[model samples]
Every structure is written in structure tokens, then in C-alpha cells.
Target: MSHPQGKELSIAVVGGGISALAAAHRLVELAPRCRLKVFEATGRLGGVISTVHRDGYQIEQSADNFITTVPHAVKLCQQLGLEHQLVETNPQYRRTFVVRQGRLHKLPDGFLMMAPTRLWPLAVTPILSPLGKLRAALEYFVPPRRDDADESMAAFVRRRLGGEVFQRLVEPLVSAVYAADMEKLSVLATLPRFREMECRYGSLIRAMRAQRRLHPQTTHESGARYSMFVTLRDGLTSLVDALAARLPPGSVCLNTEVVGLQRA
Candidate 1:
């Protein structure tokens, strides 16, 4: 990365995480003379996505698996030729349980977030009161609110569903993922498509149903290949090793740490 005004053709990448590694790799591919280097603050690279094997247990520090439905991760796997090692989640365990009333309860099938494609099951769900369910059901009649401006996850869920659903269901579900306060998580930033869906269809359920109808083959197609969750067979580290192997000799540095950054 030659500073437009400087002589050295050098590039400085902060953090030896995947983004920095991928950035350097891309730079090497596009401009071999760019002299790209990655700087990591910690003793290790790979950031939070490190794997530990102890006592015959392989544990992921963060990001247990990537969703196959997302193309970027799948494409990377194909590029690395790690397709053979790809592991898919068991289809039978598709249902994810949510913590409710100090207990884990299975979320009803066909319930995509607060949107319920199947009504009877939602109507009978113990997660919410009948009154709350009625309030959620009335969404079909209530016109979309003009105040569609960005709202927090809690606000969005409560408005569409009810206070009970937001408190018991969405709160715990969000906690499972981001582990952040519902009031702080922006619905538009986190799930913008959902904001759009409500804007288009008065009801969230109606929007999901319409989407399912439009892309029926995706959900209804029998024996759909690939699972929602995926990882490497040996472990996530295998994926990291695969990438490291692809780099040219003397390219990647191990045990390197960086402290300060400043422009000269």
C-alpha cells in the first residue's frame, strides 16, 4: 500500500482476524507488490473464532457454525476444497428451544420469529396469554404504522406481537444470539428485511406466508440439501488450517503481535 505520497508500497491491516487475513490475501491476489501486512493485538490470530480440543471435546470459542443458506461462507468452503469435511446439523433437531419461566420450552414449528405461518399452534402456545395472542392476531386488521422509522428489537416485537411475547419469547431468543439488551439492538440494523416485510404487508404472518408462497420450493421442497448450521468435520480449526495452507511460503506470520498504530 504505497501512500499516494510515500515511496514504500505497503499496506497496514489491523487485527490478524479473518477480515485482515482475507484483506491481505485479496491484496496479494490483486496487487502482489502491495506489501500487505496484518497486525494483531493478541498473541493469536483468528480473533474470537478459535477452537480448543481437550478431554476429547472440541469447543468453539465463538461462532459455532456458519449457516449454509448464506452463500459467502459456502463459497469460501468450496474455494478451500473443504467440501468433504463440511458438517451439517441434524435435521431432526431443527427445532430450537427457548428459555421461558426458568425452563427451556420448544419453540413451535413453523413459527418464524414472531410471525406464525400456522395459527392453531401459536394460538395454543403457552409462551403467551390468550389476550396477548389476540393482540398479535389483530395485526392483520391494523394498518401498518407510519412510524416505521428504526425501532429497537423489543419495541418491534412488542408492537407486532405483544408485551408477553416480547418479554418471554423474543427477549430470550435475542439473548441466545446477540446477548444484548433488546432495547439496544436496532431492528432495522439487525433485521431490516423484517422492517420491509411489515411495511409491505400489514401483518408479519401475512408477509412470511406470501414470501413462503413465492419461494415455496425452498421450504416445501422435500429433501432440501444442506443444513442451516454447518462446520468442518475435524473442527473449525481445520477450516483455518486449510486457509493457512493456501498462502505462499513466508507469507503468513505466527506468534506476531502488534501494539500501536499511527500514520507517518
Candidate 2:
């Protein structure tokens, strides 16, 4: 594309991952005639999100599906004309199991990440003991902290809920998702909404209820919408292939790692 000075525009994208590829695609879409150069340290694209075909089975190395609730990945796929290739997660067996005491236990229904929106499911779930459940339910009455300060996930959960609830429910679930030490993981960085909810409504359950009243989807959709998690029927490689095909010929430079940038 021509710059304001009537000169051809140029951009250098340094990576072969989906994020970098998406950036390059957007740049090209916005500036059709721009000289785009994609520098990749690796020979192949998609970075850690690699898929393998072995004996008619597709194996995903890192992440398999993208959630459509956010609309970015799905929009990109649609833009690339890969809509026909989109496939949703199987309706059956959509629940995740947590291992408690070396036994696999299904996560409580109506449980949205750290807290539960529905009382019946939370009441019936055996994930927590009677005392722990009572403490969790008491979250509705717990007053929120007045000061606005950043806190760790462990501290926030323990403060909002109770120690038993944090240990029995929140810690394990957070560990499974982030795999990071709870003490080190910042609640502000990871789950700022929960903090905001506490600040606004004084309790997670209260906040969730208010949110549900404001937006009916929050209650209707509740955690783990399997249909929202979509993937290419041919596997994630198809997305990379489609994106790569859209680039100008020889625009991608393999094995060229950009460690840093300097202003000219």
C-alpha cells in the first residue's frame, strides 16, 4: 500500500505462530500492496500448535480447539473461507473430570470456573465437604475488600471464599488450567473479572447473579459450551495452510529469527 508520502509501505512480522500469521493476514487485508516479510526462526509454521496425522487419527500437540464465544478465531476462519471446515465438539461427553483422591470426579454442573452460579448443583456436588460447601455458600454474605490492590489467585480465592473452598475447589481447578503456582499467579493478570466482581457486588455469587440478570447469556450459556469450541474438520493445519496460501509468493523467510527491533 502507498504511504502518506506516496511510497510503498513495508512491514516485518517475526514469527510463524498463529498469532503472527493472523497479524500478517490483517496487515495484508488492510494494505493490499504492502511489502510484507514474515521472518520465522523455525522451518515450519504454527509454532507449538502442531498437528500430526498418524494412522487416520489426528493428534494435536498443544491446543486443539478455539472458543467461538470471543469471535476472533471463528471470524478469521470465516474470512479465510474455512467455514465449511469448522466442526464443533461432540455434544455428548462435554464435561471435564477432576481427579480427587486418585478417583476421577466430574466437575459440578453450573460451576463457572472458580464459583458456582447455581445453588442446586453446588449443593449436590460431592467435590467439597459439607463444611466446605457451607463456606462457599457463605461467599454471598462475605463483604468485599474496600482497598483496590492486586492480589495473588490463592489469596483472592481464600479471602473471597474460604480456605477449605480454595483448597478443595479453586486451587485444583486453577492448577489444572494454568499449571502455575497459585501464590505467583496474579489474580489481576489472570482473572481480573473476579476481582472486579468482588469490588462491585461484594461477592462472587452476587456478582454472577447481577451479571446473569444484566445479560441472560451468562446464565443460559454457563461454563463449557462445547459448541463454542470449534476446530477445522481437517485439523488446525488447514488454517495455517489457508493463511500461508494468502501471503505473497516468497514473503515468508524461514529460519530468520528476530531477537529485537531498532528504530531507523
Candidate 3:
């Protein structure tokens, strides 16, 4: 929609979640002279993003950090002038642990999500059996499917890696992220990059290797790559607070429920 200059244009933004707040902020940026109103159903904002400080400890109730691979979150922080407050994950404790047979085992180094970039770590890791490791290693030789149709993540992983790798490693790791049945989860809907890897380089391992070569700086160290995950030192809620602070006074309505909208 185009708003002529000096014309009083009124815009109503429903909800108070991060998306809504960002939208409101964008509207203000685009049309400073326009009147904007924000309606929130609850007393507080941020939706699932909540941070609380209690008993001399600061805790994040949800969404502690965001990955930087997708730079939208980082760009938003920069736009809010919170880049100085951004902090990276500790380099020392970056490895993820998975439970197997009532034991906690560290995820193999260079093992990103579903693919393994380093063979030595996979060879020594006890999480996978000799046969499973062999099958996973064979992923480099596997042929890629030419079909453009969508496929389930379970099917893709099993076809490329193997049943053992899927059940033990891929399944549990993916489950932790999506909390959905892999058989029903569309790889295109969730992680299309893995699918793209198959189509582009014929294997996930090959794609990862090429990516590392392209950006070696990101993988210079082992364990959790601290640069990938970023958050504000104060908390994620600080973002919400910053956006809310930018809106004009009396423009926000708390405990206001919007049932529907109609174009008049």
C-alpha cells in the first residue's frame, strides 16, 4: 500500500509477538507520519520468548539463543543497536550429548546434524557400531535421487546413510529439534539443505566438505561452533523490550483480543 506524504494513515497491528513487534517497527520506519496501534492479548509481550531474573540468577524461560547461519535474527539485533550486547556460546562446552542405553555420549566432532565431516571422529565414536559407521561412511558413494518430489526426512536419511545410522543418531537428533515423527516430517519443509546437498553434490558429506572449504573460518575449532549461536548478554527478551520501547506511547493496547479483520 502506498501512503502519500502528510496524509494521516492509520495502521492497526494485531498481536504482540516478536513478529508483530517487528512489523510495527517496520511500519513506523516506513511511514513515520502514520498513526499505528498495537493490540496484545496478554499483559506482557515476547510470546514464548521470556526472560526472568530471580535469586541473583538470570534465566531464559524460552528461546535462549538463535543460530547465525540464518542472519535475520542477527540483522534484527543490529538494527535494534544491540549488537554490542551480543554474546557467543562458550567454546569450552559446545558438544551435544545424546543418551544411549542409559549412557550419555558426546556427539561426534564434525558431525553436523545428519552428516559427518570428519571420518576419524566417526571411526572412534562408540555411538555407532562398526557396521553402522561403515554404512554412514558409504554416504559419500551413494547416488542421489533425481526426483524433485518431496520426501520424508526418515526416508532420506535411511536411503543415504542407512537404517542403523537413522535409528541411533539421525532419529534422536532430529527428534530433539522437531519433536515430530520423522516418517511424517517432510525434509523439504524442515531442512531442505540436506535435500539440496543430495541433488547438488550427490552426498551430504561432499556438500559439507565443500562448504567447509568455502568458509574454513567457521570450522577452525572443534565442538559447538560458538559463532553459529548468538544471544544478548542480558537475555533474548531484551530484544522485545527494545522494540516495545520504540513504539509511540498510548499506541499499545494490552489484554485486547482481536477476533478478525475485514478490509473496509
Best by TM-score: 3
Clashes of each: 1, 2, 0
Number of clashes in model 1?
Answer: 1
Candidate achieving higher lDDT, 1 or 2? 2
What lDDT tens digits, residue by residue, belong to model 3 across residues 1-264?
455554578899999998999999989888787788899999988887899999989898877888899888889889999999999987666667778999998878777777776778778888899999999999999999898999899999999999987888778877766668999999999889889988999999899888888766545344445458988999999999999999988889989988987742
> In model 2, how large is the Cα lDDT of residue 94?
64
Model 2 CA deviation exceeding 4 Å by range: 1-5, 120-126, 146-148, 175-192, 196-201, 207-227, 260-264
Over 4 Å off in model 3, which ranges? 1-7, 178-185, 210-226
lDDT, candidate 1, 139-171, per-residue tens? 677667677588888888888877877776667
- Candidate 1 has an lDDT of 0.70
Top lDDT hit: 3
Full candidate order by TM-score, most accurate first: 3, 1, 2
How far out, in Å, is residue 197 in model 3? Answer: 2.7
Cα displacement (Å) at residue 254, model 2:
2.2
Q: What is the TM-score (0 to 1) of candidate 3?
A: 0.83
RMSD of each: 3.8, 3.4, 3.1
The lDDT for every candidate, in the order shown, is 0.70, 0.81, 0.84
For residues 113-136, write the lDDT of model 2, one tens digit per residue: 677666777787777888888888
